[model samples]
Target: MEQGLLVVLNGLVYGLLLFMLSSGLTLIVGMMGVLNLAHASFYMLGAYLAYSISTVVGFWPALVLAPLAVGVIGALVERYGLRPVHRHGHVAELLFTFGLAFVIGEIVPLIWGRLPVPYRVPAVLDVPLFALAGTAYPAYRLFMMLISLAMFCALFAALAKTRLGLVVRAALTHPDMVAMLGHDVPRVFTLVFGAGCALAGLAGVIAGNAFTTEPGMARSLGAIVFAVVVMGGLGSLSGALVASLLIGLVQTVSIGLDLPFYKALSALGITVDVGGRLHDLWLLSVNRAAPVVPYLLLVLVLATRPRGLLGSRSA
Candidate 1:
């Protein structure tokens, strides 16, 4: 029972982290219709920036400075890099962001080298928060959960209850109308994009030390972020939350289980005879297959609901 609870807690932590990373992309894509392929690069940039800033000032300050810096960079990219391409349609926008991601990928290695940095958790949060089933849960993980939950609440309130959110949502579906109402629609787009990137940066600042800060970190997470977005629905924040938690729990549960395919099947009162290559495949344990589970879920979700769980529009 304790082990199961631990797995669930870990899953929630992982899921919330995924939401933090993907929520920005969802906002940008949903609001502006521009798929920022370089979104994950911004996340990677945040981690690196936090690492550098923390080395000088400390983690608390880096937590604020890194996301702000990333937001500025994102705003600049939208103004100079993305605005010109906007006139050319989505294909052009996609190509530009893809190339931008490539450039950032190359530049990171040059700046940080091909090594994992020592972005360890701060000493203040490095201790155990509590014990469960004789196992200690790290306080940092709880801190991450708190931050993620707080972000969700703030973001939800902003979009669902605030004036700026009304303007942004209005601009999304009626840009000409919003522009005629004395709003700078283009400026709104820039702010939305920057805000989205800032969210990604904040996730990086928190997750870097929790996980690892490295050049390939973005590449590793990039695919899963897309999967979460697609599965949750393209523009739905609520959908993202549900999908993130679902994927997190699924992956965690898979990792926690040690049963092989045949044994798992037997538990359901089914049996299969296999041999050679097929036998080897059947012998694979659930834990060993954990990495593939999210993609499988993605495929399943896409096959069943093309619009996603709570998405109003089709992807």
Candidate 2:
């Protein structure tokens, strides 16, 4: 029971972190219909920038400023880089962002070098928040859960209640109607793009130290973020949330389970020989397969429900 509780807690933490990274990407794709392949690059920039800013101004200020800076940069990219490519086609736009991702990936190492930067959690929040099942959970992790929940609430409220959210929702579903309604759709696009990037940056600010702050961080996380978006659905915010938590829980729990197929089957009174067809399968362990779990879930989701968990559009 204690171990089960620990797994649940860890899963919730990880799921929230995944949501932080994925919410922005889903918003951009849902509203703008652009994949924004470089979104994770923005996350990488956020971590590096936050580290630099935090060293000079402290963590509190860095939390506020780094995301704002990234938002401005995202705005510029949407204005100058993506707008021109929009005329060509989505394929061109995708290629543009893909190339930009490569460029940023190359540039990061040059600026920060290959080593991981020391982006530690603040000492004030370093103490244990509480004990659970003989384990002391860090205050920072609890703080992360609270912040992520707040973000989720803020985003939902904004989209559901505010005039701006109404506009964004209408534009996403009916761009032509929104344009005809005398709204500046291009400006809306820019703001949404920037806001999406800001969310990614905010995720980095909180998650950098918890994970790691290094040049290769984006590359490591980029695929998982994309998987979350895809599994959630191409343009569904709620779907993203559901998928993030589900994937996070599955990954965490799978990693923690040390059960080998052989032992599992033995409980059912099924025994296998060393050279039997089931031999390799029986030897496999969850720990060894943990890294592939997300992708595996992705494949299963795609195969079963191409539109994603809560996706409205049909594939």
Candidate 3:
């Protein structure tokens, strides 16, 4: 029971981090209708920037400056790379972002080398915040959860309450009408893209210590993100949030579980008298299969709800 509880808690923390990344991606897609494939590259950039700065100065400075730098990079990409591509169509815009991801992937290794950088949690947060049933929960993970939650709240408030958010919401649903009213659609699109990339950067920073900060981190994460966004729907921010949390929990919990579905089937159904490595293979599959749970969920979600859960029907 205690172990199960810890696993569930960890799932929640990871889910929040995924939400932070997905929130921005969803908003960008929902509002601008552009599928920015380079989103995860921003995450990798954030981790690298933090690692570099922390080495030069300290973790504190890196935390503050890395996201800011990434935001600028995202803004510049929007101004130069994406804007020109946008004129073509959403598919072309997607391909443009995809190309950018590969470029960033190559550039990261050039700048930081192929090895994973050593990035530990700050000394202040190195120790666990508290113990749960003798299990120590690291302070950094707690801090990450809090920060992600706070960001989500702020984002929700900004999108739902503020005047700027109202305009964004309006444009997301009806860009043509909003433009007809003389609103600067281009500026809004750029800002939304920047904001989305900034969120990805922030997630990278938080996850860097928890996971390894490697040049290829973004390459590993980018596809899962696309799956999350697509599973959530094209333009629904709420759907993105829900989908992220769901995937996060699914992935984390699946790892800690030992369902051994195939092995169980041997006992329930007619037993295939497997000998030697076959038995061991089934045993190994129990653990190895857990890692793929989120992707399976993504496929299932896409298969069933092409529009995604809680996704906006239009725009």
TM for every model, in the order presented, reads 0.94, 0.94, 0.89
lDDT values for all models: 0.93, 0.90, 0.83
Lowest summed lDDT across 10 adjacent residues in model 2 is found at: 259-268
Clashes of 1: 0
Runs in model 1 lying further than 4 Å from the true structure:
262-283
- Which tens-of-lDDT digit does each residue in 45-152 have in candidate 1? 999999999999999999999999999999999999999999999999999999999999999889988899998799999999999999999999999999999999
Best by lDDT: 1
Candidate 2, lDDT over the whole model: 0.90
Instruction: Put down candidate 3 lDDT per residue, 1-315, tens digits, no spaces.
Output: 888888888888878887888888888888877778888999999988888888889988888798888988998999998898788998899899889989999999998899998988889989978888899989888899988988988988998999889889899988889899999988888888888888899899889988999987887887788777888887777777788888887777768656565565575684544564576655564446766777788778767876777765632
TM-score of predicted structure 2:
0.94
The deviation in Å at residue 282 for candidate 2 is 3.2
RMSD of 2: 2.2
TM-score of 3: 0.89
Position 239, candidate 1: lDDT: 92
| Per-residue lDDT over 136-167 for candidate 2, one digit per residue giving the tens place of the 0 to 100 score | 88999988898899999999999999999999
